[model samples]
Target: MQKIVPNIWFDGTAAEAAEHYARVLPDTSGRVLMRYPEEGLPDFQKALAGQPLTAEIVVGESAEDGGCRIVLINAGPEFAPNESISFMLNFDPSRDPDAAATLEAVWAGLGDGGEVLAELDEYPFSPRYGWIRDRYGVTWQLILTHPDGEPRPFVIPSLLFCGAAQNRAKAAIAAYTSLFDDSGVGMIVDYSTATGAVRADSVMFGDFRLAGQWFTAVDSPEPRDFSFTCGVSLQVNCADQAEIDRCWEALSAVPEAEQCGWCADEFGLSWQIVPEEMGSLMASPEAYGAMLAMKKIVIADFPK
Candidate 1:
């Protein structure tokens, strides 16, 4: 299992989205979809009856070349995807000769019933690039990589600090890298002007590694109607209970946001600090039932 996975929440579209991604993207595969159990709380059971609970999907040629495994949930409409967080797809021609064609095909599929954020065209940074929010409202940034530059992961989760969170991207990056081992800051481009909607010294674009996994972040001073929500969360798989406890103490900031192993950091980003063994334990109904009653997971409570 991947140490870190991006979890997406949808309003009954998780299965559909996962299927579409598997069908359109190269080297992609969708796993079996899971549904809400019939025995859950009456309200939850009635609300989510027979609805898709989770959908797993893998993207990229292989793990060695920066593949990504994402989990999706068909939760209710309590939240929706927004530009606050997006996924960046790096199409390196050096790795794949057909990178351009692949990018265009992907753009077409995702653009259907979607809005374009940036038109696909030659930018100073790359020959082909575009940003779009798919029909499901999830944003994606596609860029044709400079063959001469160092290689990056095929898919990287990106964070956009806007509104009240403006100018906090660098701090968030530093905080995250410090909490996880094998982490460090990467390329950072700071904003030049501090006037109007731009904040000087704020991150214009940057990348960082947390536990060897790459992620991107940017600071946007523009006001928006949306902010971070539980609709999207980052899951950190821990090796042991000690690791989980340490991360829980370090990342958790909102006492009211703690539930079922989920916590909200100071930046308002959600994280799931889970033991790697929890996956196996979930196969047992008894263990699953026990987990539903706790905030910070207790390994001892689950059966071996």
Candidate 2:
């Protein structure tokens, strides 16, 4: 029942990726809604088009679809996953009379500096959108007209991981499920082919529920760029500083850790241990001075 769900990536081009993607989709708003982990927000990286671990972008759905709902993550290179994960969009069939046409237009825009996989085609499953690794080597599948058109704007039901790192998929799935409550592996199909005949779908692909969102992961032989950093960060709304520190300490425990709340976990995935009320606090005049004082902060900075 998540209205606007995005299975994002943190390739070096988070801002560029968001800007590029925003151009193709209908909404087309000014770039940048929010950037996080004050110290982690890089100056040279942004100029170099480096990946971002924390970002919020507005794509698809202009005024009709209801504001910029989709978000991207540039959480840094440590957290970059191959095409095994992607974002899926569910267009409103009843309202979008020319869904195919609109979808194709979007494809063309995003495809400007990117590659196309299946082109814009009506598949047996649904009117689908497919694109292989973009210029940044990120894969995406944009689907239109949900099977039931049930006002489900978007869903990350599962993620598809491809490339030489199939085994890594299992490790990532297991690690993530352990961190969040109500998380467990759903369906898994592993290595079922004609006696070791490695078809594209030979590896394992399954579903998992993390936090409250549903996602899928798979392993394929596709090569991926190690360009993903901490640009696209998962925005967790914490109840208090206790919750923030609990998740932060648990996730960011690797050497690749950076300031401004970005860190690589033991699993190589990047995360931001940001406060839930940080956004509201920063928007205030008083907090702005404190924000400028330090790149990263704890609860004491914004005491109750």
Candidate 3:
């Protein structure tokens, strides 16, 4: 019942991704939170006539530390990677001493043909850290908080961006840390003259808080196979059109911006600028009708 359940947008695999998440996470289950059940056989047939069915699921652990729940929703259209959103993982190095190795296996399993943005390495920011995308084209950052046998948890919370110009991770962190109270960067390491930019003597790695949650970021200058995509988009609930307008303008400045509440920042991530009352409005039995209403929403007329 937590208000903020991280929401993941799928090209068309919300149910599928939720299942995988349920299996991979610590103590969690992915169950269908909602589905468009056939209203009337005729209407259902009409709805199914040429449209695809959609489903949403809540996935996470039920334990004390496992309050993480993500809602995965299927997309009505095909999805692509752009810079409007990205998924982040908060890894606990203490839970499993071999946590780093185990994470590599997860990447290897999921990232068959996906590019390796960064080979696993011991970062100054953390003991171990790296980034990779699965064959499914989803981006993931694996951070090992402690490698020297310490107590920790592995968390992979997704993030949303309004719009970033080139690569928004750094900028997003900067903007995010700016907006939230009691949130800031934990550690930042850049390529020193000694290390050089090619790799760098040290790069940023550490906790950054946004909306009171530990968020982290690093710069990836290249457009790798694993860029941001709708498979995981952050959903921002704005208070009013004025707020929506501010968010939309800032987040849609990138080249990969798209229709239907989707946009990529300069960094190739996607995000959704939704109204605060959207959840409540769309939770009713008429949600599908609302989705139908939303399907016609133009980026310019979104809110403001």
Candidate 4:
């Protein structure tokens, strides 16, 4: 089961963005998971009435297929997705014979009205790879993987620790691994000394697993204008209230960032920790109203 899911906030129409991804990426499809309430919405969200509140896009048919799920949020243009958090798509030749061709197709599709940060060409590390930001301002890194490397999922959420959060990749990964079960650090490659723009003792590339999901973290030697923000958040679905409480206590570092079950960690990354019953609980108008006023979700307070 997927315990942690990546949530992306889009300034444009989320449903359209989901569909765009489905059309571009292979073995992917988009569906509207939840719609905004037709009535009793706040003024800011009034325009989104009867529209998709949350849209989901699954990379593969199932988790057993080594795929992942992503949630696209429907909200105002308050937040913008940046390179600070991006999804890494791996096309392993061992798993698929046409990995190179498929990667090219994905790269071209994502390049539609997208800005290429790294050209799609051979690099020292990979024969074919590229980093780009799509039309919706969401970034993705597509890479053709070597068959001999350790097996991993098709999709991996990556973090670029730059700006104010530079050189904290190790600490951030440690904090997350300690909070979640079945989590541990995988491979970590750090810079030994400062090299021009590169910083000393910074993580060049590090990957870890949290709740069975693969994620990579990179400590940017060079600073950028962006860092972690609410635009890209990780949503954790808990089995019960106890799990939610435990996760909240361990991850919530900013008191002011807590709102409606959402909290920002010390690394400035946003997270939504909620019970699996969240959808059912928020079904009632009363419960929905109560959630708007909550800091940490209390399942007991929800209407039964």
Better of 1 and 3 by lDDT: 1
Superposed by TM-score, candidate 4 places the C-alpha of residue 204 at a distance from the truth, in angstroms, of: 0.5
Candidate with best lDDT: 4
Tens digits of per-residue lDDT, candidate 2, 1-304, equal 2221343565456677666665666665434545544443346444433224445555544444344344565545655544444555555567577777776776666566777766667676575756545665556666777646434434353344433333466777888888777788777776555233234344455667777556666555444544223433344556677776777776766644655555666544445556656667765445534554443356577523
Q: For this target, which candidate reaches the highest TM-score against the unseen true structure?
A: 4
Residue lDDT tens for model 3, 150-260: 332345453432223323455567766775456777666554432222244323333476555554455443333444566566666566767766667777755445554
**Number of backbone collisions per candidate:** 0, 38, 25, 0
Candidate 4 lDDT tens digits, 135-196:
99999999998899998888999999987787799999999999888999999998989864
lDDT of each: 0.85, 0.55, 0.53, 0.90
* Model 1, C-alpha of 145: deviation from truth (Å): 1.0
What shift in Å separates residue 76 of candidate 3 from its native position after superposition? 5.2
* TM-score for each predicted model, relative to the true structure: 0.94, 0.63, 0.64, 0.97
Error in Å for residue 225 of model 2: 6.5
Superior candidate under lDDT, 3 versus 4: 4
In model 4, the clashing pairs are none
Candidate 2: residue 18 Cα off by (Å)? 5.4
